[model samples]
Target chain A: MTRTTYARAIGTALATAMRDDERVFVLGEDVSAGGPFTITRGLVDEFGKDRVRDTPISEAAICGIAIGAAQSGLRPVLEIMYIDFLTLALDQLANMAAKAHFMSGGQLSVPLVLRTQGGAGQRAGAQHSQSLESWLCHVPGLKVVMPSRAVDAAGLLASAIADPNPVVMVENKTLYFRSEEVPDTVEPVPLGQAAVLRTGRDVTVVALSGLVPEALHAADALAADGIEVTVIDPRTLVPLDLDTIVASVRRTGRLVIAHEAVRDGGIGAEIAAATGRAAFDHLDAPIERVAAPFEPIAVSPVAEDAYLPRAPQIRDAVLRTLGRELNREGCRLPRPTA
Target chain B: MTLDTGHQITMYRQMVRIREFEERVKRTFTDHPGVIRGHTHLADGAEASIVGSIAAMRPGDQAIATYRCHGYPIALGSDTSALMAEIYGRVGGICGGYGGSMHLADIARGFLGTSAIVAQNIPQGAGAAYAAQLRGRGDVVLTFFGDGATKQGAFHESLNVAALWRLPVVFIMENNSFSVTVRTEEEDANAAAGEPLATKAKAYSMPGTTIDGGDPLVVQQTVADAVARARAGDGPTLIESLVYRLSAHGNSIAPPGVPLHYPEHEAVAIYGAVEEYEAAKRGDPVPRFRARLIESGVLTGDQAGAIVDEAQAEMQAAVDFALNSPLPEPAAALNHVYA
Candidate 1:
């Protein structure tokens, strides 16, 4: 098994999908010449210009062409270069691809995948750092996937390629160079499936995409202090794995949902709602969430860190879930005087 | 008239089908209660634009259009029954009643679809044309939008790309004088009446033409010329069909003074005269051709009337077919939400 970065895993999946199906092609600005971030290096060499195509700097046209190609018996994998630019193609994604099947009485299917990157930490600034998984999940026909690790990246990409509908596969810009061991085989992980990173009975910590690793680290630290924490990663937001989240919350009796997006209208709210509805009776405390503050991400690195959720916030949320009162210093739950 | 007749008979039948079907749909809107309340942008005056353009295409050729798309789908081989059911928002409608008036799609008929958003069809149609070009087949694409849509950014962008790539697409603009109550004078102060709106295509180094949309034969000749030009790899052509809107922009817009602006009071009388005169012309299609059918002893008026009657009956039966069909299962909505 070759160890690879999450970025490499994505490239490998693209190459594999292109090799497997002649209809599958990639289109984006600078995608042929190493892409905007070098994720697609060496693909053009193998697939040629016809399959690995470069497009003009038009996001709307890119998405529109992908929809047309998909409708006419082609699987077009479009890259928006950045998730923030998805705003430009919202009409194609929202009105065209999402409603094609339903509005056409199931006669049309948009077998397309959009790979784009989001999240903060590299000082990419307000324009490029928006986490829009929540915005995409709002649309009915769009499938949303955000993978945290190398294996999940490759697995989810293959699944999205095979999907009969449009899928928005978001990768974290900060995690592109982040490395992990990716098995040689490409096994598509089923969408709406959540992975339990750690098992504990004290509290449940649900995180998404890039935030999952921070959540696991926080859980490990808390476990050393005798506070066992269960960490969960909801891989796909649209078909949210509510069953697993509810089961974990039912066992732990506490929930803390975290994501990199701003607190309001974030994936955390959807997960929090699902957890509440499914495991309302099992709750020992109110469900809590840790997310970025509702403000434009700053261009400065120091401010960017402050804008996103961090390890300490996860630790504090976990501590609060265990019935421990938290001050600036940390945990302060007094033992019961039975 | 004759079963072995060429496009002449076929185009006439298709145009009559469209004109009659639209008229019947208008009657239903005024009569049906509890039906959807929205504007049905009927293609009454512009029937030739769709019929003539579609007549020039082959079986595998493609079509796409904007909101005023009922004619294109009907002309492109969609069953008249299904189309009527769609406008009525029945379960058996082309889009399962989800797309009321603004959206109509029938993939089986090669009428890709229509969208409510102005100019959205431009880029999508160009893409399909690109696919046809890539396949090395002589398949052509016919994309229709109104004069109002010509002002959109996608229109300019799509034209640029289409001209640059020399894709096999024919752009037909039904310039119907008004973009929803706003007269063309208020919007396009420079465009002369009866002149081709090809200024944009000029910038792209492409050719364009203007034709009388009220005359299907003229419209047919112009489109055939453009399709031929396109098939020969001459790139896209911008064909403007100058016609008047036979009715208000939508059903909601009532007469100017009498609370309902249903075209001018004499609009129907005028179009009716035109239809009659054209029917009377010896060379004109429709009734004259129907007469030839009877004169040649192939079929009697009663037989032709029976076919029209059967079409009407099938349309009525489709309503029942739609009404009896079950509503989509609630779970099915969630099933397609994701792949």
Candidate 2:
């Protein structure tokens, strides 16, 4: 096993994929200069200008070109420096890649991967740190994958590149520097499969993207109180593992879904609804959700922290589902490692 | 005019088919209550531009056109019924009823697709041609847009890129003298075309020409030269085909004259006065080609009418098939968002 930062893991995956397939190429603004975060550092030197293309500041044109290239059998990995910038390319992402196959009656496929960074925590402000996974999840043909750990981020990205459809593999801007032990072996994690980090019987906690670590911490804290909690990380949002989530809820009879996206239309709502509908008979308590409030994320660190759901929120939701109360000490559970 | 006669006639028939089809679509929109609720633009007068360029391509060649794409796809070999069903929003339509008249895309026939977004297809068409060149497929692409499209940034950018890379693509400017109510002359053609649309091709270091688009055969000759040049690895070409739209910008908008450049009465007399029967008959390139075929002794009028009738019947069957096709499964709508 090689221990590496999330950024390094992404670079390694790109390097490995490019080495294996000549058709693989990278394009985006500032990509040739090692990317906005230096995630693609030294790639241009090795892959040459043809493979590592630096495009103009036209995000839509970049994505549209990638779609055209992918349709023509080129495996293009487009980097949208930030998730907020994806709004500019929404037409290509939503109208072109998302609907191409369906409109073509399955005769054509767009095997393109868009690797973008999202999530708040770096105090990068509203525009730089939004988690708009829900917006992508609304589109039917696109696959939305956000890995919780360095290992899955690397593995899932490889699988996404191999997919015959368009894949939006969003990495957390906060997680780029977050290091973890990644397996040296090249593994392609199957999309739509949820990873159970911790198993408990009292509540089934489903978290996505960068929130899984915080969820694990909440589960660990709840475990000490004799309240068993199972933490499920949905690696992919579009091809959601509703079956696993529902089954876990059925077994536990309680659910608390957490995410960094806005609460109203977030992936958590969908999961909660699916769990409620599928395992309603097994519920011992109502489902609880911890998510960002419905509003434009503010740039202030204080406001951003308040905007994102923390571990304490997750822990509180778990205890609430278990019918437990922390009194005044509930505010001082433990700071999240995120 | 030898072996190409069959192909040329095929191309001519394609034009006739589109003219007829667009005429029928206009009639359908007018007669069928609650069919198309908005302004509908019929390519009533632009038959030559569509047929001429389409006839210039070989198998595996690609085409990307504006919303006025009826003739391009017919030339590219899309089924008439598929097009009819598309206008009808039928389930089995080319885009599964998702794309109506403005959003037709028949991938199998190499009709890359059409977008309602004006001038949006320019860069996309260039990209497709780039892909074809990169793949070494020897396939050239023909992209068409209206006089209005030439004013878009995408048009200029795509032309620059296509020229820079010497990509196998042809950019056809359908100078139909109007963009809705706006006339080409009113928009300052000198500034827009930059010394005639054909000379603008020279800026990209490629050959360009303006053709008489009133004659589909002449248009075909010009387009064929460009297509052949592209296939021979000579790079991109810019073709300015000067044709008349013949109708109001669409069903809702009045003719070009009402807005300014030309007289409204003349615009109507020329474009709107196209008899419903002639609009439907020569509406498609096939009817005009059939007349030519009879004059040339290649076939009798009866034979050509039979072909047109058969084409209509085939289209009717496709419309029925599409209309009867099942609606998409509710859950199927959730599929394909990511891939």
Among these predicted structures, which one has the highest TM-score? 1
TM-score (chain B) for candidate 2 is 0.82
- The digit string of per-residue lDDT tens for model 2 on B31-110 reads 45444444445675677678777777888888887777666677677777777676666666677665667767887788
- Which runs in model 1 stand beyond 4 Å of their true positions? A325-338, B1-5, B188-196, B232-234, B253-339
Residue A238 local lDDT, model 2:
70
- TM-scores for all candidates: the values are 0.88, 0.82
Candidate 2 has a DockQ of 0.26
lDDT string, candidate 1, A187-279, tens digits: 988887988888998999998887898888787777767788888888888788889989989999999998999999887888888779889
Best by lDDT: 1
Worst 10 residues of 2 chain B by lDDT: B257-266
Residue B226, model 2: lDDT of 85
- Residue by residue across A1-338, what tens digits does model 2's lDDT show? 88898898989899999999988899888898888788888899999977888777777667777877777678899999999999988877887787777665555578889999899988888798899888998887889999988888888989998899899998997788876887778598899898988899889999987789888888777766667889999888878988988888889999999888889877777887877888989999989998888888888877888788978889888878878774335344664334
